[model samples]
Target: MITKNTNLFVVSNVTNLRSRVNKLYIPKTKSLLPLFEIVSNSIHAIFEKREIEDNYQGKIIIKLIRNGDESTLKELDFIDKYPVKSFEVSDNGIGLNRENFISFQEFDSEKKAKIGGKGIGRLVCLKLFSKMVVESIYTENGKFYSRNFEYKKNIKEGFDKYENPESEKTITGTTVILENFEIEYQKKAPKDLLDIARQIITHFQLYFIEKVIPEIIIRNQNDEEVNLLNLFKSEFESEILDDTFNIGNYEFKVYITKSFNSLSHKILYCAHERTVKDEGLSKYIEDLRYIIKDNDSLLGYHYQVFVLSKLLNEKVNEERTNFHFSDDEEGDSESDDDITLARIRRETLLKVEELLSSFLSKTRKEKVEQYIPIIQSEFPNYASVIEFNRDKVEKIPAGLTPKELDVKLYEIESEWKLEVKIEGIKLLDEKKDITSLEDYKKLYDKFWSEFNEVGKTDLARYVVHRRSVIDMLDKLIKWDSNQRFYNEDIIHSLFFPIKEDKDTVIHEKQNLWLLDERLTFNNLLASDKTFNQIRQLNSNSTDRIDLIIRQEEIFDKATLFSEDKFPNDSFTIVEFKKPYRNDYVLGDPKKDPVRQVRKYINEIIDKEIKSEGRSIEADKTTPFYCYIIADITSTLEYILREEMFTKMPDNIGYFRFYTSDELKYKAYVEVIPFKKVIKNAKERNKVLFDKLNIS
Candidate 1:
């Protein structure tokens, strides 16, 4: 009786009117984050049903599969009636009856729902697969009813249809099957199903641990139950949240884990209220999405922080929320409001910083010390350039791309041919005697002794009782010697890169060295080495220049001035210095050797090389001069300002290096510009292009 648009004011069937606008269908994007959110919602759905029914303790089983008979088959394999990729999520919590099932069919654009709001989670199943069949049971009117939704032709005929049968079932739970879906990343040979299983176990480990020991069995292509838990054990323990704090009426749960080598401090778990959506760092990170709120509510904008410390000094504020941590002791008392949320962000960050410091102080520093030998023995070429010291701790600089720097790190460390291997005793039975407390003491003593000798400054005795350390090391040796014996000479190694050439060029700083010591360059040379690895590590005037012999490479500091003559092809000469331990300590040009080398290189190129009638012609010679500092630390910066040179030679090179600890601490390097080296475009560009054409 009513045409398509004739009776638009009908109020009796308003549900269908709203449903038409909401469009209870799936989005056409491939993202595992949404899948994760869906599963998370289902997990809570069961729990919420239990809570509503006053069911205190119940179990929910969730399964993910990639292949099946009625699978969401990829379009390419549709004829075979076989699914190339499929997944299943089944739960045993309170099942959905007629109302819940129909409610699941609703989609909220504004994300306003009493139950997990945005019931579009169901559509996520559809997004990941072609057709999803939800088998659910509901206990209402003193009877249990079973129903499902399958793909069928819609009334329009062009769109897919939703078809299912209603029946009665004795069980009280739900099973969802997604069929005929193509994995955007993998279509034919999809990613291992175990990966999805592992993710389910990992991201929701706490959820399972607090409730049930999830009976997760992953099957290989052969269909045998593969042991997914064993592989997940290492990560599961690390993800467990053992720390708790509070802020702004929200309860914060925190978990922090350091890398086995003790170089990284990561936040494994951080959440607030009953959900991970509203408070701490969300899975979806952006400039605007700062505060995680329940049901997509906005809490704050950009609320994350990190801090470092050398020792424990104060009580961490357990009550503060919505903040981050900073170990800059000088700025602790400063207002947090200066950064973002100001007072709240600052104080919360201070507490987290203090917590981390306390944790670090209590932890033994010897874990990272053992890697030095592995690096030296494994990557002889670049190992000598990097120096890792356990006594030093370098925090990240204030800026962006710290994580991008990590990506560049793996390339360099891998190219450098470094490996991670352990030296000393073997394992016997289920335990390793080499890990005994006594052996730890011995290694500890040996470490500090070397530290004192090389650093020339004995640490405070109270740091670790020397006598106690001797006794511990003695016990360790005796225990491991009597047990499984692994020769100490057989050291383990982990291969890392020195320079990895990728397609994209990252610009950052370079650590230069003019001092008489080798230095690590990862922290400072992300952009510098990236340019070099990409054959772009030169100024505008001389890309063909090679054999960059430095004073530290040839004659030590004392004899550097004696060599006034440099090779004709030595295109660049750069000098640099390691920054002071205390970054705030302004550099003294008189003491810092970088300025001296830069000056010497300039004089040699300007007075000696340029005077010899060297031409920019292909037959003639060219060289440049530059200097690099270990960091932008205050000391090195101070020297740059104090020495104050307006210009430098056209044909010289300069660069700096990073501390070994800082280099290996992260995985990537930042790019730094050599603006000073290419100041004279016309002359320099001519020389560079000429060299390029010659090459």
Candidate 2:
């Protein structure tokens, strides 16, 4: 069963061969990665032939066999529809001579070590297929020799050979037949010619560009051929750079290019001019695009980044799909040396990514800058619209697609035209020359209504700003440190002034907005200075009230709900207390928070407190809103329970009280704890802050 002339190299213990090769990893996406291994050897064999015959032209043909099972045959009318059965690769290279067969017998052979070859390409084929048939012819010792054999897992371990000095022929080549595709590898194969062709072009782009690689032809059962050289020629018309850079002891040559064909932006990693890894850099470029603008219209150019380094081969994993960790950083050793090397490797990769990121962003911006002047000169108003959109852009605003831009361009044109007309109308003389008062009022009302929407926007922004301030104030309530706290005056200064020196500076600025935000809309007559301390105090003056809020007819701020809006007639009286001031909560009838607000109401109802000749009037026929802010102490809780304030309604703070008559004078009493107010403000304000995308 064996020929004496050809070397019948027997691998010692075939099971050991299987066990050894099985340890090598093969990734799922690269089931057909064996094609690279097979072709690479063919290229090497071709080079061997070139050493003897310099004019030799290497040629490799790859053919795929389709399945003819009944299920697969049912789609006879379909094109390129059959599931793949096998692959055959034939190369006009120096055949599998004695030297080659010798190298194949060794484990981790170093014969091609200098050229970055591991001499284990056969494992890739064995992993993906059930069988291989090798046939080759070559001149050895001036004799024509041929070796032919059926290769299969767990089968005969050696090849059969035939030879004769008189049988020299004109042709010398090797044919490697791969059949019986493993079941797991079937689905990942690209059945379409274009798809597989693109994969090959992407995988072997660096090879085609740098080396005189053999002319590779791929064909299926349909007999369509894709020429690798022509494919590369069509796409790789330009090269941006071919330069070397160093990282540590490893020198890496990087090649960049712009493609006019079906090439994605990728950084291809190669070992000895053969691709070892590749990854598309689109995601990294996308990061830069998002930082520049949220708009989706910013598409960077199609480019390629190829890098070759012996370090790739030096650091390859068992699978060769990934690089291994640096020597000092392997396994689970807790040595400081491991940590240092690991950190260095990680930082090195990150630095490389950073460099690529800078290059992509600069190139993309330069490409887009060319069109800026043309866009601005022809569409000035649209330019303004773009700037406005950019100004209002949040951290993650929705990006604009082409269709959205088409719609937005029309909206921008119409809005700016309306703005031009409004400016024209403001130049009209009809306001001063109106013959009737009703016409003047009509014009005023029309303009005012148009301006009112701007007020609504301002109101929304006010809510957001106030919420931010409240969120900051929340940290102060339980702000105890080393048994220390903000004294009563420090917390009081945030709402209303505590010290007399700050009275002039803090006037009308009431930051304590616990009752409702609308309570802030009212005008302030006096705060802390008290009704009695005024320059011209009337008979109704009372020093007990901490704050006397005045509601005038119209003001700069908007009023919402029934409290601050409509009628605008009530006088809001407030009594703020330091939460630590438990003396105010004592049952000594005069010190109760409830009794204090009622006293202010009686003073306002009994007499007119005039401020600079403007009489602040309140009586049983006038409304008085009394608000009391203090700790919800035990004594106050008992008083609230006793006063039947337990059945208080919703949206109302806590307790309800009427001064003499409910129709004329009203007061809502809420004894709030500092902790509750701080927690509520933190919760509510967090929502607003998150909505605005603030950190």
Candidate 3:
């Protein structure tokens, strides 16, 4: 019978244990966390025993239970082990005494608070397993006692048939049977013995580093036993470097070690001797993206850094999966500076980089050596920037592709330019004090050095652009798979855009320099435009010239066609024919390119040309230079011969001088093949390309 007190209310236990379990978050990948928790409890119990008895040795045995079906065994053709069903962990430590029994019955108990126990490991166990059964024996007041209990979800009191001190027991130990692994979690759990052992080692690696781990053994149904202590010593043990750092008032201890089994360098955050969070070291130090290989032994290794601090222990959530603080520094309050995980990690990585300085320096040097040639041959624009900023280049990660390297070098160059700009401004500042004549001279010289280097980089970029244009022109003139050549408009647009004039297209957008460097300084230029459309010509005829240029003494548009224009002002008419085109009809002004140029020049001389109603200063003595760019086919060669044009000494082109009696002027004409254009352009830019060391 139960008696009711006069109190208005009383503290009550949770009614629905399943709802409590559902509230906890357990990721599928972390299905083994339940097993780790039970093992951690056993380890803590052993620590409790050691405190009482000095000579006592701690030992734990984990038994694996698997499904024994003949059909399932036959179906697994390659697997030697069956799927595990449950696990039974036994520890010869202080069993559940009366005080511990009371603590176990309550939720959120603080009995094991000194050892970092959150009093919810058993709840975590029920998340994966269907039931938990415990049997233990302990001595109280010089007398041996026994306890037995079974925890299941369906039980109203969370446990059934609780027997305390029911009968006498000889020894003291506890065996927890976590039975009936749920199918959802069992599929995610590791099936192999070695894999399971590795998970345990990784989880409790901090304990192993502290030399406080106990003797743990894993046994399968086949009686195969694995001593975890031996596994740690042979495979995971290494020379460890221990150090300490501080973030604000919180102190942190770090343990750095090398492991052959690690695929990449890692940083693990620990709280209460258990790793709660981890991040790849490559996220901070890119050189550690892959394992570090040893030349002498041909073995690859990577670092495993463990960080422990009291603040981390206090901030650890009840699930021990993460901390209460934010992961990013910005997520925390501005008044509290060092409470975020990112802040702690940044400081910790600084120490890690300091400790691995020698290894990192060697690897960085090798990376820079491999990258120098790539910049010289493929990215000449960054050569000077990289040479001056070697320290920034060393900070870049290794194993980058050409495209990635281009982006990194571009970023570095932009930063260097900004620095140079800032320095130049400071040097010319009126408020800056002139300490001495030598100091001022030194500052001025340094500023000019960086400024000149920037200028050289811009020039190199322009040279590279020229090389690309030359290559494109060479490819455009080649025959296609269909045995046909590119049309005239395609080639015409390469030098100057069709239907556009100098007023619409800037000099930088046109490649007129490929034909003649002097053409780039034209006072007026037009492509694919009729005589009537030109502002400098007053002719009403609609004959479209392929390309036309007019040069004057002064480059002012107002004086381009004024009466003050120089007598030496000249006119250039260029015509483009399809590559390898042999369909030329002699004396047909439309078909014959030479006659076409002559007709356009005759109209220009006959017209009353003026700018803003001012008489043009041109006379019959003004020179006319005409060019026809096309391949020297058989039919075109005959046409050139009939025009009295003499072949060039190289036999690649033809040139002639024609005297016009009606106009009283002399005209120079040339028929240049496509090959000669590419060859001459390359010859003109060879010196610059050689200086930049580019192909």
- Per TM-score, the best of the predicted structures is 3
| Per-prediction TM-score | 0.36, 0.48, 0.72
TM-score of 3: 0.72
lDDT of 1 by residue, 1-695 (tens): 21121112111112333234236443333335344654555565566566566634544444434454323332222222222355555666567654554455445523224322455554444444555566666566676656544531121211222323344466577766555554662353325455556555644554444433434454433343444455456655544334444444433444332212112222222221112122342221111122223355443122223221111111222322222345543253444222222333344444555554543343323323333343333222222223432222112111224344333323443432222111212211235356688885765555454333333211221111222222332332232545642221110000012232223312121112212123212112112231223232232222211113321233232332324654333223332222222233334334454434333333333432221233321112332333342334455445445545222233222233322342211111111112221222223234423322310
Q: Write the per-residue lDDT of candidate 2 for residues 307-418, one digit (tens) a residue.
A: 6666666665554555565564534444433333234333333444555555555544554354345334332324434443332211111344434543555465456446
**With candidate 1 superimposed using the best TM-score fit, by how many Å does residue 593's alpha carbon deviate from the native?**
39
How would you encode candidate 3's per-residue C-alpha lDDT over 420-480 as one tens digit per residue? 9998887677575779998777768877988999999888888988888888888889877
Candidate lDDT scores, in order, read 0.36, 0.59, 0.79
For each of the candidates, the C-alpha root-mean-square deviation to the true structure, in angstroms, is 24.6, 17.2, 7.2
Candidate 1 residue 239 C-alpha distance from true site, Å:
5.7
| Best-to-worst ranking by lDDT | 3, 2, 1
In terms of lDDT, the best-performing candidate is 3
TM-score for candidate 2, please give it.
0.48
Rate residue 462 of model 3 by lDDT: 88
Global CA lDDT computed for model 3: 0.79
